[model samples]
Target: MLKPGGILLLTTHGDITRQNLLPDEQQKFDAGELVVRGNVKEGHRMYTAYHPVKYMNTLFDHKVTVLKHKAGTRQSWGLEQDLWLLQKGNS
Candidate 1:
């Protein structure tokens, strides 16, 4: 939990992840839930969660003040990411 006035930095998958989703996984992505996939390596899995800017703003409404929100590209990972900086409210 964050104390009042504390700032939080968050990162999550962006729309690019949705574009790369497998045909079967598209439905799940459309439902606004995180998607998990088993890795080729044994006993390992990957998790992805995407959040639109609008949704993120609404989510923090009355909770935190959004200081910044941006979309970033990770070429090495072939994925786009959302970055958010939020500060806790005094209340």
Candidate 2:
């Protein structure tokens, strides 16, 4: 459920390169052989999954119209991160 004229803002890691942990880094931070820290953990630089904008648009079609969409990378602390902003239609 949503309210008329209300805003719905959502964001996610944009690309595979912007998410996930690197192999060696994951190994160093692993609690076990098959475990890794959180996806945004420090030194993690791999993405295990990708949910491109096209997919998101398809998923939201008919259910919610897109008012605006912006995508890009964010740099800080020598790391690159993804960003997105999506809005629902005003009714």
Candidate 3:
């Protein structure tokens, strides 16, 4: 577990990254659900998953302090991600 008061910074695929997903996947994502793609046999980037903002926060729930949350602009290849800056809970 992250030490209490520890700062964690991370980026992940978010809504803006949904454009590349299929219709069903997009629907699931818009519904505040996680969406994943790629084959298991492929390399890391080839298999990816994204979480909805709502869902993402839920994963941490009351366990952390969200210092910042922002979505980046979509890239030329249609990739965009959300940034999260968090501080672990002291509890």
Candidate 4:
């Protein structure tokens, strides 16, 4: 559990998933309540989750105060990333 006023920083795949995924992947993302994908080429098949800005904000609404939310594409990778900074509430 987080102490009051503690800071939490999180990052996730952002809106770019919708733009960069293949048609089939996008279809699955649209249909699923929560979309998760596995990286097959990585030998250790790890799964990753993606979220839109609104959903990401909602996920933490009850626990913390959002200090910042940033979404943008990285120039080198050309992939969108969501960065969030949250301060834990006293509740």
Q: Judging by lDDT against the true structure, name the best candidate.
A: 3
Q: On a 0 to 100 scale, what is the lDDT of residue 73 in model 3?
A: 81
Give one digit per residue, the lDDT tens place, for model 4 in 1-91.
7799899888887776677666876765565434567884567877777676666666777878989988866677677677889899876
Local accuracy by lDDT, each model: 0.72, 0.51, 0.84, 0.73
Kindly report which residue stretches of model 1 are placed more than 4 angstroms away from their true locations once superposed.
Answer: 23-43, 74-77
Question: Lowest-scoring 10 consecutive residues by lDDT in candidate 1?
Answer: 46-55
Per-residue error for 88 in candidate 3, Å, reads 0.7
Please, what are the lDDT tens digits per residue for candidate 3 over residues 1-91? Answer: 6898999999988877777778998889988898877774555556788888988888878989889998868678866678999999777
**10 residues in a row with least lDDT, candidate 3:** 37-46
Candidate 4: what lDDT?
0.73
For model 3 the local lDDT of residue 48 reads 86
For each of the candidates, give the backbone clash count: 0, 2, 0, 0
Model 4 spans with C-alpha error above 4 angstroms: 24-33
TM-scores for candidates 1 onward, in order: 0.67, 0.47, 0.83, 0.73
Per residue, candidate 1 scores C-alpha lDDT tens digits across 2-58 of 999999998876556677677767676666545565564577765545564555666
- For every candidate, C-alpha RMSD to the true structure in Å: 3.1, 8.9, 2.7, 2.7
Clashing pairs in 4: none
| Index of the highest-TM-score prediction | 3
Clashing pairs in 3: none
The count of backbone overlaps in candidate 2 is 2
lDDT (Cα, 0-100) at 24 in candidate 1: 68
